[model samples]
Target: MLFPASGHTKAHVLHYYAQIAPVMLPHVAGRPASFVRAPEGPEGESWIAKNPPPGVPDWVPLVPVEHRDGVTEQVVVDSTAALAAMVNLGAYEVHVPQWTAAGGRDAHDRLVLDLDPGPGADLVVCCRVAERLRQLLDEDGLMACPVVSGSKGLHLYAPVEAVSGRGASAYAKGLAERMTVEHPRLVVASMAKLERRGRVLIDWSQNASAKTTAAPYTVRLREGSPGVAAPVTWDEVAACRAPSDLAFTPEAVVERAAERGDLLAGLLGEGVRGRVP
Candidate 1:
């Protein structure tokens, strides 16, 4: 099932993902080409490629792609060149019947935590880090969202401007860094892990305008499926199961969004034109 039908290597399927690269473009519309491909390896195959992959062994799906009668829709987007190409091709990120969002109207500042539990990191520790972050935000009356990384970790994000008048970026970086510094045992925001010893990165750097974190529902080509992320409320996170103990599936995620409506819905409709202001 992992093998591609007919005659395609997993590498070929990965290349196909790169060739498409239109899904991520629209979401990052206002930003410049800070987007980079996910990176290729020695054999030159990757769904996205911005850097040299560190022997990320040629990965094939652990599970077979389920048959849905039709191709499970997909979108690819990376790099400014890719964004331009997608627009030229008339690709757009829109509300599909399967995926829909509502409510983010009030122009609140957004700070998403791209929680990467690390390649070999412990999941229990990841959940603990998220818990601490939530406490810090709630004491300050901030609105945050928790999401599954779709790979190895969990992300915890809090809306800054909603509570704090300004200092949105500063606050996000400050909290992310503090999580690493304050709890040396649980977290790390350092880009270089060896330098950080052993710790999970809080990853608030994605808050910068020039940067863009993977949007919700976006796929990480490495994973067999779309690897869509799961968004959870602070209350849910408080109950605290464990990130490693959980794998938020695509069906569960879309289902959850449908039940609660999307927290980012209004933010998506904030009317920020793609053009630079």
Candidate 2:
């Protein structure tokens, strides 16, 4: 078993990926993916690998991503088999860019704002911050989708016409700065630990071309319960009053997807079109 806490075997993880692939692949396909591997199980050490390891199957898709060092082949999970294979390889989480690999590094179709709560704050605090962020986006005539980070906070994503990653990052940073200024009690744009005492950190820097976020439905291997980066409805967000309400397991996430379909499917299609003012 790869996850000792959950007692989930490698086959279980593989099945989870295979079952969720139909709804999850669109978010992963054609994107440069960085995986978190726990070869010795969740109780042991884990490492993040950006480059595709050797001996990957020929059918598995890979894209040559230029890093500061050089071009390295990055694995792109586009098929159910590829997804399952990655799970079998001890990858506990899938992280990807906001744009397709074909779009290059700078071209991003989405802007992400990470609502990270301080040590004193919690998920419910993040939920409130996310709703406020959503309201602001709506005021700007943009639509925002919220996803439980499966860790400590929430991630708000807005789809826009293809924009440069630098441009998107700048826009998000400006929005976060404005929010911090307007709502000092609840939002903090600065990364300084002391500044985050009672505020949620609106991490706009995630829009950078080199940055990545957890793919929706990807399972996370933490110390305690395994968490799934699951999509949630606005209603769910409104109802969330505790962190446990947002946390989901592999089986639970699969079941939720089966019953609710992909709540994040709209992001792949035409979404709200607007630029940050």
Candidate 3:
């Protein structure tokens, strides 16, 4: 279905996952995945499949996660077979929480900061805001890695040594609020679009329990062509002129992983402490 736009076939997408599964699984395994499938094609309508749909093979693992109202079964992409199956099922994108299944819903393994451009702003502005966040994180004795969202912005992730969902949420929220106060010209923490005008929003809500960020190396279905949520270095972020500059297809992503290894692999281990008082 995507052959016309991206020149990629279903087989190509599956092969891409098959090749990158080794590196990708290390980051996604044991996490509750919210599969974003585009069965109709990149340009066609798509839906987010939270629970394992009917007819899923028994080999596919499922994790029961509690929500505000009740508990639901979420799929975990732990194996190469599972990843390829999802791709064959038209799951173009995979979004997972910062925690693992062993940690369940409480223990979070990482902290993420999503830098989104406001209404009047673009990705260039987003890059500037990300740089400021990196500097602040550096002062805190933490290391933050940048990942191109492959759409409109960048996401910064830092490994949290020993932190829970609550701790991560509070720390990220505080930092975002602080950025808005310290850098009023370029940053805003408000979720309101109006408040985001001419500024880049440091979205802090993704740190909460059960929240999911787009898994690295997954392809995003957007206008024109699909874009891969590829990991990038700080230098690439600063040098980028537009969002498309960081865009990658399935083929490009696999090649990138082969060359650079997993840029996000370091985030899987113990990192700087939250140190929130």
Best by TM-score: 2
Write one digit per residue (lDDT tens) for candidate 3, span 13-55. 7787899888888878999899888887767778988888666
- Residue ranges of candidate 3 with Cα displaced over 4 Å: 271-277
> For candidate 1, lDDT tens digit of each residue in 1-277?
1222234243443433343334333343332211224233112333432222233222311111112353222222335454334322212111111111121212224556666666566555677778888777766665446766656767664433332212344666788777767887767777886744456777766554334455544433333443445555546555656653456544555556557766444334434211111
- Candidate 2 per-residue C-alpha lDDT over 1-277 given as tens digits, one digit per residue, 9 for 90 to 100: 6766667787787788888899999888999999998877778988898977555778888889988888988999988888887877777799998888898887798889989999789999998888888888888767898888888889898877778888888888888998888889888999999999888999998898889999888987777667788888899999998888888888988998899899988777774556655
Which lDDT values do the candidates have, in the order given?
Answer: 0.46, 0.85, 0.82
The window of 10 residues in a row where model 1 has the poorest summed lDDT is 92-101
Worst 10 residues of 3 by lDDT: 268-277
Q: Which model scores highest in lDDT?
A: 2
Comparing candidate 2 with candidate 3, which one achieves the higher TM-score?
A: 2
Segments in model 2 whose C-alpha atoms lie over 4 Å from true places = 271-273
Model 1 clashes, total count: 19
Q: Candidate 1: where is the Cα deviation over 4 Å?
A: 1-44, 47-108, 162-167, 235-245, 263-277
